[model samples]
Target: MWQIAVVLFGVANAVQVDFRPYDHSAELLFNGSDFNHDHIFSRQELEQEFQKYDADGDGRVSRHEYTTYVTTSVPELHDFAHALYDDYDVSGDHHLDHHDYDMYYAKLDADSDGSVTRQEFVDYWVKLFQATEHLHGHGHSGHG
Candidate 1:
């Protein structure tokens, strides 16, 4: 379902050439899903996005900088940014350098081989879907 679309979008977005397989349906495909710019960022795009958060052009994003980026760019996750920072900032230095970014992807590596292939990324989403599906409609009180 959504996982399939994510892999498709990931591959399409990763291509350097002008080929855009998902352009036609990108909105219809991802409008309601949590899949966003981050999910489809190519290796280059990921680096660019990291640089966006790396204020002062220091090549590293401090926790405060990342929190600010998330606050302005994706406010829905701002409250959780610190948790994400804790997860991605592996060195405990409260900053995310290139290696820390690599560690972020490695968390999704699935196989621990130091890289996150498309398949691994899609699998991770699928598993996350499965794990969260049961909680989707259970919290509502149905009073509205």
Candidate 2:
């Protein structure tokens, strides 16, 4: 049942986009799952997000750069932001755009609700980062 959910969740997240999970073992970060760690948002995802949020096309993001992240009683918006924030803030720029937002929102909104909530953040991250249980140990264990 859990495995089914994982597969379905992945399929759902990638509804309209073509996201290829990278070779995570190659990078050795091991967010506790998969060779690509793509089940969660990968660096590729962050870059894409950066491009999206960089509204000025300046090629760099300013700190706390404001953008839209809508919410409703339906939930999912907050959850999507939680899942993506730190990760998508590549170069530590600390901001995101519709590209990054949409990418992760899609991931969290596995059922395609057009929004995300806090619980979805925990659930999706748990599956992508913990469900596969790919972590090994210490400062780094899987790298070779």
Candidate 3:
């Protein structure tokens, strides 16, 4: 689903991929900066995110609770997290790797801003999902 695609995009962008042909930008991204894209989130940004979700002032988010909240809230991103856990959790460690993060980062950060602002990330995926959803919803009506 769109959720899986979006998360994959984000994680991929955060991690660099080995390019065989080496297109212009892919070459740059593959070799550029840290090649790990560690600058995805600043401490300020993470704190802000925590503030946004930690509505009860509990100062913590458990894995189950956080996953539910995100999935229910977006309705589209639940599949994304699931896919991330499935594909990129290479060692079955139930966690993401820097390579995964780099790959996701590159795909989502269209503007190459070095950081994915939330709105940018959402907008990028929203358009992708909507377009794909329309294509999926299309039917020939048995008339074609």
Candidate 4:
């Protein structure tokens, strides 16, 4: 029951989606700089990043843990981060397990066949990067 305020490109009206923790988690994969401007994350990178937040060593990042991650790692998103976690409790089981993570990836399944191919996954992240770049105006900022 979290509402994510998303501004659609080329649309005057804004829409709210059932914001999920995966959305914020995925968004955080971008570096917003020269280090990883393309937002291309290899499997190892994803695993390493996930491992950093999966504090309990339970192979899952719960809502409380994700909230802490967002507040500390990406404070800019703190205001709405908790809502995203709440919305992701798809099973009403109160925990975001591996199935929830897989479901998030399944969302990028363009063909809607219940799985994401390598191309689809890559393309989705690329498109996300491009859109972010566009929204931020043209180029990546460098820390010199």
RMSD (CA, Å), candidate 4 to true, equals: 11.1
Best by TM-score: 1
Task: Judge candidate 3 at residue 17 and give its lDDT.
Answer: 22
lDDT of 2 by residue, 1-144 (tens): 011122111233322111113132222322332224434544344345355445577765443332232122212223333433555543344655445455555766566765443344445655544322322111222333
| Candidate 3 residue-wise lDDT at 69 | 55
Worst 10 residues of 1 by lDDT: 1-10
Computed on alpha carbons, the lDDT of every model, listed in order, comes to 0.51, 0.38, 0.40, 0.47
Off by over 4 Å in 2: 1-97, 131-144
Would you list the rank order by lDDT, best first? 1, 4, 3, 2
Poorest lDDT segment (10 consecutive residues) of candidate 3? 1-10
- Model 3, runs deviating above 4 Å: 1-95, 131-144
How accurate locally is residue 84 in candidate 2, as Cα lDDT from 0 to 100?
A: 38
For TM-score, candidate 1 versus 4, the one ahead is 1
Which pairs clash inside model 1? none
TM-score of each: 0.52, 0.28, 0.30, 0.44
How well is each residue in 19-108 modelled by candidate 4, as lDDT tens digits? 223345235333321133444433333334445556798977777787777656334344455545554444656577666555554555
Q: How do the residues 12-56 of candidate 1 rate in per-residue lDDT, one tens digit apiece?
A: 323111112333223323332223544442444445556767878
Q: Which candidate is the best by lDDT?
A: 1
Clashes of 2: 10
Tens digits of per-residue lDDT for model 3, 1-144? 122222211243232121112123222332233223453443233334434334455654334444565566354445433543343233454433344445555655678866764444555445443443322222213321
Cand. 2 TM to true fold: 0.28
